[model samples]
Target: MFVSKRTFSTYRALFHENPLGLPRHKPAPTIPRAHRGLPKKMPIAGVKNVVVVASGKGGVGKSTTAVNIALAAAGLKRRVGILDADIFGPSVPKLMNLKGEPELTEKGDRLIPLTNYGVKCMSMGFLVDQDAPVVWRGLMVMKALQQLLHQVDWGQLDLLVIDMPPGTGDVQLTISQQIVVDGAVIISTPQDIALIDAVKGVNMFKKVNVPILGMVQNMSLFICPNCQHESHIFGHDGAARMAEEFNVPLLGQVPLHADICTLSDSGKPIVISQPDSPFSNYYRSITQNMLNRLQEIK
Candidate 1:
């Protein structure tokens, strides 16, 4: 099934390199906003690259992957910041247990991002009530995203990870069309429904002329707890085949581990809390690959 899909994509590539041809629901919908405000366009100096972690649909562990990958970058002893661009469902604060609003530096109204696990973090949750509905219009969301990138002073070094809202929506398009994304990492499980959307996501970036770092197969496998046997919970290698079809790098395959769920909910990522764990090691390797790619991209 996977191979056939790729073959079609390859054939279609001639018509146009539409990485994301079309979403399952015909045309993708843009969120409604009363006003269309121009996003404040400003790049943080010394921040080498901006990498966005996105997916065709939600609930594919995109946020979790973004948080862990950012944590992994910090483990490499580099300054990092995560922008919780998922305004409607901000999870960076909870995933990393980053509490409190960013403090203001003495630099005359300059707001400083909060630090955790040696990484600077910022999120909408910290700014307002976590559980309260965002009640934001599209234009407002864009304005907020822009403020995060410009208003805050993300000091020096390494990369910035933007945990984008799911799907190819107005906000995502606004960012991709405006912000100079260094690259994008699309996350998906091994299911047709998920992959279909994942393809849409990959193609969305492609349409915007953004570099696709690769496809991340989250929940590629599930190891039984009692017997230690691996099971193809979602199926196998769909992402790998997709990567081959698109000629993008297949960075790594992360399994469904019990520890990842438990530790992450406790604000302890497997990478930081259990560095020796297999899952943690896998993330480290993926992060290294991402870093090497970033260097090559530069």
Candidate 2:
């Protein structure tokens, strides 16, 4: 009756080895020979869908959206994971409220992901000091990313949401070429400058043949708490217009709210911290729409 949550989770992990909740553990289907040579997408052992949340540049709330989306999907009873691929500025550890180096498996070959809020997480932030700077060259960065991607024992996850570094860079290219990403979600504010970078992101993904799941217009609107007046602080419908022009679906919009910022800073994403709130609903709806689209595509 007084079981600690960690103990219970460990018990569950041991007893419930079926991380995907499948009837029986089976190997994933092989990639056909015809498709094998196409950019050589390497499938993660136990992950089915790999969704990358990306932005054209930094400071657009991309990591925040990625964390909330992973939490929201986990709330729907799916085994979810998040990989913070931003080596220079990893935020998943802070956003997920996890720290320290992850534990090794019994064989001591792979890293076990740290868990929080029912979502397993991995990031370079856990391996180094928070204040330390990552000044590695591109080759070193790619090696680190490869370890994070392939050396983690992620178990059986329905979806692995990657919080990608901003811009079309080495890490992004490495992931696109090495991982069989199911789809990508682009995040951008409504400002013209942000959208301009967002366009570059869309083009990059398109060039790599990664399906654009949709675009999320973050900080789309702001509501005055006192007068209930609405304002387009960053300008309005820019993401929607971009989505339409580029033939990508406009997944959803997240309002600029004080609570969103506070909760995120506190390592409690709004989706889990205030599930009943309107802001949580925005994230949940986007998750649902994304699930629906994945289903349709399959």
Please give the RMSD to the true structure for each candidate, in Å. Answer: 13.9, 8.0
Model 1 Cα displacement at 171 (Å)?
2.0
Please report, in order, the local distance difference test score of every candidate based on alpha carbons. 0.76, 0.84
Cα-based lDDT at residue 212, candidate 2: 93
Decoy 2 TM-score against native: 0.87
Candidate 2 on 124-198: residue-level lDDT in tens? 887667897977776667666766777778999999999999989888988888889999999999999999999
Off by over 4 Å in 1: 1-42
The model with the greatest lDDT is 2
Worst 10 residues of 2 by lDDT: 15-24
